[model samples]
Target: MPNLLRKSFNVVNRVRHTASVAGLSALRVAKGERPDAVMLRETFEQLGTTYIKIGQFIASTPSLFPRDYVIAFQGCLDQTTPLPYSYIEQVLKEELLTEGQSLEDLFSKIDKEPLASASIAQVHAATLPDGREVVLKVQKPDVEVIMQTDLGVLHGVTKLMEKLMPQMRFASISPIIDEIRIRMMAETDFIAEASNIRDFQQFLQMTGNTKVVAPEVVEELTTKRVLTMSRLHGISMVDEVAMRQYCDDPAQVMADTLNTWFASLMFCNSFHADLHAGNLMLLKDGRIGFIDFGIVGKLAPESWQACMGMMQALQDNDYVTMASCMVDMGMTHERDKVDQAQLAGDLAKMITRIMAEDKTYTSGKPFNSKEQADELNKMMLEIVEVGKRHGIHFPRDFALLTKQMLYFDRFMRTLAPDMDMFSDARVSLLGSDFKQ
Candidate 1:
């Protein structure tokens, strides 16, 4: 059989298996048996690369999936079985070889054991001839074929869902799939990741943020399928205990991280989209290091400008301006648009209640109190419900931005109980004060 036909057959078989497993799990749940999220995660893992990636994406995109599924799939960490050393050698020979230098010439010693393996790529620590330690990231062989086939299956499934439920405005699953496909393709190219690193490095240099670090890409030793970058030493930011050992001011580190990300959003044109604990680390040199630049988000100039306006309006307590800016950002559809005047009135009422509860609060800290947090969350939920009733569907980007801010909110509560995110001097956007 042709390679494409064989892959398609495999994909169809995998999809059938997935459906069977999900159905069985549903039946078990219906029978009052507690279904294991880990089992479901493992099922996706067994289905191969694309499903694993989708599982991880589902874990991150809380706004899109149900809470139970998201919580369960969070256990679906990147853990893939390693490829054979022979296959690794073949890839190196085919993809990394230049005019004369061979795999043996490139590395003085190559580790057969992979350091880590994910759905798309695996990392191995290798030593250069000159004694420099580096991490070699190799793209899985035939991954592109597998991803294309799986994505096709995903498209078909999503299309079926849309047809079955016309009222379910699930943000056009096709565009989301297309976006994921673009990102996956870019990720398969190490050269693109190298360029991303260079771009971020240049941004750091210009900004004079000495506390931030990005790994230097070794261009001479890097290729399309394999990337060799300077090996950074440190624990992930999620390791709070380990991080505290390196820096006395873990809160400052968190602050610096938020500041750096905010700066990137305003100035760099491109910002790291996937910044879960794994992608952020505390380096030995007391600086923040960011890795895995394969996925990024770009905001058009107008969108960003409108975002600035929205933030400014929030600060100034001008709900009308905030609503207008949101409209400009296309958060609310025309047909489903709530009465702008009524939205402004309701928002003002909520703001007044909040202000009455805490007169001196300008930061996110005061809301961290359980009662206050509940009230705020309730208010926001009401707002979203009202928007939904009005037929206003929020874009995915807006949802993602809000989710990231919520992450920051949680981080701030843990790290700096008193820090006011809204009024922090370090949280400047676009090199200017937010509209207020």
Candidate 2:
């Protein structure tokens, strides 16, 4: 089996190349271990930062990864031992020097301990010289090289696997790896993230989204490897108790948050792409805090327009319009060749299969992660199969959108247990004038 570890090189990345080949061979499960997916999850956890980041991406991207892998990688947190404060200081000092300043010139104090630690970076609480509290996200040393080396090898293996297993050709593996590579590269560039923060804040204001807030970027104190922004006081939305303490109506809070995100998908230049529960929080001041704007998603105008119509069609269970919208969003080489009725039947069958698989034996209780992933993976596979059969090329941005919607579904399942996200009046999936 040519796993995601194919070639070796004579360059500096040789060690990573060797490890890729070695790591796959070492994945054989020992006695008492759960399963292959569990072993792979642990293997990624042990393989250092880039692999952990890869696992996180796998966990979040249901459209790309398999159900078991998705369920397994959910445990891949960015959490790690905090690198020394001096290392953090060193990065801050170096990045600031380019702007003719030092760490001390901007910050009054930086805490010795980090608020959180991840494979790529760690965040520390600090106070500006003007006494404003902020947090600095400093990237780990040699992260870009590690990511590059690992991703290069992985991409090769994916191409190899595509040739080895003809059945796997149903989904574009190389494109998925390329997508992940683009996202990882963007995340390492904090200068881009700072710009994203500024853009998101502006989008919030322009959309009259008073409840959701993105921290203001501090340009003087930010850099390509480090981000400095206002520190928000809040608790994660996953923290039910703390959320309840801050938000009187948690349901309304979630609704508002969803609406804001929904608006961004259509109106903003880019939407928050990686909104795992931890990235969003409920602030003490009764506002929603959106942190870490590293991985934002964007779509072409035609895609969003088709998406809006598709949502309305889905609401009405109008498979004909839904099929037409999907085909419109995708690349159709020949408009005359598209069989709208056939597409509609395929989509209707997919929906029916999904409805059959979605079983909540106990009312008001959602299925577990594995169950949900299984159902979702089945539906996604069906959709892809339909696309392949019809000679349609669905856009990657649409896949990203699907992943975000899945994340929101998990959110509503946890926070607003009984809330039907699409049908909920508060969530305008389309504009107010949108009709089925």
Strongest candidate by TM-score: 2
Q: Per-residue CA lDDT of candidate 2, range 54-164, in tens?
A: 787777665556667877887887778889998988888777765666767788899989988887889999998889999989999877777887788789898888899
- Give the alpha carbon lDDT tens digit for every residue of 29-97 in model 1: 799876666667777776767777778666655445555676677667676788887877888787778
lDDT of 2: 0.76
For candidate 2, the per-residue lDDT at 142 reads: 75
Model 2: colliding residue pairs? none
List per-prediction Cα lDDT, in the order shown.
0.72, 0.76
The 10-residue segment of model 2 with minimum total lDDT is 2-11
Give stretches of model 2 more than 4 Å off: 1-41, 59-75, 98-102, 156-173, 311-316, 331-336, 353-381, 431-436
> What would the TM-scores of all predictions be?
0.77, 0.82
Q: Which residue pairs in model 1 clash with each other? A: none
